[model samples]
Target chain A: MVHQYKLNGYHIVLDTCSGSVHAVDEVAYDIIGLYEEKTEEEITAQILEKYRGREDVTREEIRLCLADVAKLKQQGKLFTPDTYAPLANEFKERSGNVVKALCLHVAHTCNLNCAYCFASQGKYHGERALMSFETGKRALDFLIEHSGSRTNLEVDFFGGEPLMNWEVVKQLVLYARSVEKEHRKNFRFTLTTNGMLIDDDVIDFANREMSNVVLSLDGRKEVHDRLRVDYAGNGSFDRIVPKFQKLVAARGGKNYYMRGTFTHQNPDFTRDIDEMLRLGFTELSMEPVVCAPADPAALTQEDLTVVLKEYELLAQKMLDAKREGKEFTFYHYMIDLTKGPCIYKRISGCGSGTEYMAVTPWGDLYPCHQFVGEEKYKLGDIWNGISNHGAQEEFCACNAYTRKECEDCWAKLYCSGGCAANAYHAAGSVSGIYAAGCELFKKRMECAVMLQVADALPRQE
Target chain B: MKRIQTLETKNLCESAKKGGCGECQTSCQSACKTSCGIANQKCEKKDER
Candidate 1:
């Protein structure tokens, strides 16, 4: 199927099946739009009527444009067939359950009390707990044991605030390092924290041992403080921002993301991103908050419109900034058109249950951190491995094709059927599509494509 | 009116899909390597033109 849209002064057409992107002029765009549905004679007549007075848009030129569309289709770049549908299930199955990543919830508790905390203030609506070093060690061992021929395995030390259990976090890294070479594995660890406990030691060790670090900051002080407040109801923005700056500064150009969440309160989330840029934080991601619609922080219908425009503006701003020699990386806007993820990766979506799982502080496994509290999703523990084979199979099958809503969606390949965790929360099933999220995601994809086009086709002065 | 210009004919269907698991590349939808270290594009493969 083909999808067409006009954004940022450019007409874009996406061949959904073949992943080809074309930027055509208004005339060619109109002709291509009609090529699949109308006969050549009819399309020419329509274009002639539409561009009646324009000499450039003659019937012959219209037919020429139509021929170009036909050429693209013949080359398998336009109106391409869904050749990957039959291969989706078997393609993913070939990966064969070789787990390569594990999210170790080192602390099921947080030092701060962010009102919009999806994990219910890091307790995940459960008792506050910290994972023991032994449990973490076993979790690393579980990864190595199941990683098959994969040499590089990843472990993310996540939590309400992982620094809440600082000693164990350090110990687990030491343990993983101690055994990585022995097991013929290379462990890349990441720490996701609120920046509440960053210090010289934390920064030094993070730069040394951790391959990457994710610092949680919701942009500007007022915006971040609105929901991410401390238990005493005071803003923790001041306390954390400086520390985050220091840690990232010491990171020595290593991998780090100044991750934030955008909600109804901040639909003009680009302002928050600008604040991050002002603070010298380059790699960034401001994800939309996925919560109940009834919640005050939820993005309302009006906010969706604002958010969509913001995505377009964000892309343009990034391109302009690059020209001015101040380009920053926005996570979703980073698209590698040349060597993007293979079709199987795009089809199967995020491997939440099949190849990746989240471990709780008590060593119990869930498909991801979002499903941590739900007993039904519990996929056994590190010691016993995945006992809930049913959930595993369901997630393994839950790819872009599994969701009916994704069938005709143009952005399905980029998002890989959307996040299963967000889908479950929004629609009450992993296979269900989060409609609002889809809208925002499509806009982001459009903006990403436009940015790529702008970079390639610099405008003439 | 630039005509119908193909900005990208990378053809992810035929080329990209054939490679087994590229969990670390920016192309993967997971946002990062293996377990989603969260938007980790530090290792983004430069375009091999």
Candidate 2:
């Protein structure tokens, strides 16, 4: 299917199934829009009348444009048929459910209490605890054992505050590095922290060892301070921002994300993004607050309306910045149009549950961090591997085409059927779809497409 | 910024049918896909100044 839209002074057309993108002038754009339903003669007449005053839009030019659109259709470039439904289930089969990555919850406790934290302040509704070194070691071994023939194994040090158990995180990284060579494996380690405990040692070790570091900050001081607070009910923004800035500065050219969550309290998230930009943060992501509908921080329908406009504004701002040699990258807008995810990844989604799983501090396995502490989703422990094969099969069966709502949606392929954890939380099933997240995703996809169109296509005016 | 129209696809998965899926490690990011400010993989490509 061909989806057409006008954005940022350009007419962009995208073929959803085939992943073909085209930019055309006004007459050509109009003709391509009605090429399917209307007769050629009718389209030509409509275009002629629409552009009647423009001498540049003659019937001869319309004919050529019509021929070009038809040529694209014949070549399976535009209006491409959806032939991926049957292959969707085949993704899990191709890899044989070999494990590839693990998100190790080193600590189930947080230094700061953020109101909208979906992790429930890192406890996940459980008691506070730090993963023992023994548990972490076993988790790594579990990943290696289950990962058949895959050399590039990934482990992310995540938690309430990974740095809270600093010694264990350090030891785990050291252990992984030491064993990787003997096993003929390459372990890429990443760490995500709130920047509360960042210092010389943290910075030095992260730079030297971790493949990537993710720092959490919610834009400006007021917005950040509103929810992210300390035990004393004091805002932790002041405490964390300086630390994060110092860490990023020391990080130099290394990869990092200055991540933030925009809640209903701040649906004008573009301002927060601007705040991040002003703080010299270029690599950023300001996600909408995803929580139970009853939660005060949860994004409401009205908030969603504002948030959509914010995405559009953010895209336009990025384009302007790119032109001015001040471009900042947004996580959602980082669309590698040329060589995106492989077909297997595109159809199968995030590879969670089967190819990837989350390990709690105690070594209990879940589909992902979002499913941690939930008995229903517990697949097994690191010692015995995945005992609950049913959960694995369920995640394996879940993909872009699993839900009927996603069948006709143009953004289906991009999002990979949305997050399974989000689906389960919202719709009470892993296979179900999160309607709000879907709407936000569609808007982001549109903006992402617009950015690529502006950057990759020739503009008419 | 001179934007040019382009088709950005190598369709590598197309070759997977011929048994080419697992061998390619291609720039796939983090294992966990959930975006709970925790597991989401950071994809930051900083442009060299």
Give me the TM-scores for chain A across all models, comma-separated.
Answer: 0.97, 0.97
List, residue by residue over A215-326, the lDDT tens digit for candidate 2. Answer: 7888878999999998888998888887888888888788888888888789998888898888888898777776899999988899999998889999989988998999
The deviation in Å at residue A337 for candidate 1 is 0.2
lDDT of 1 by residue, B1-49 (tens): 2497786545666654445543453222233321121111222224421
lDDT of 1 by residue, A1-461 (tens): 78899887888888877878888888988888888788999999999999889989887787677878878899888988777777778777787878888888999889899878888899998999999989988888888888887777888888889988989989989888889888888888888888888999999999998887888888988999989888899898999988998998888999888889988999999999999999989999888886778888988999999999899888888988998999898877777676555566677677788777899998999887778898888999999998999988778887778889888777777777777887888889999988887887787778888888877875622
How much lDDT does each candidate structure score? Answer: 0.80, 0.78
Model 1 lDDT, residue A318, Cα: 93
The i-RMS of every model, in angstroms, reads: 4.6, 6.6
Give the per-residue Cα lDDT of candidate 2 at A86.
Answer: 84
In angstroms, the error of model 1 at A44 is 1.1
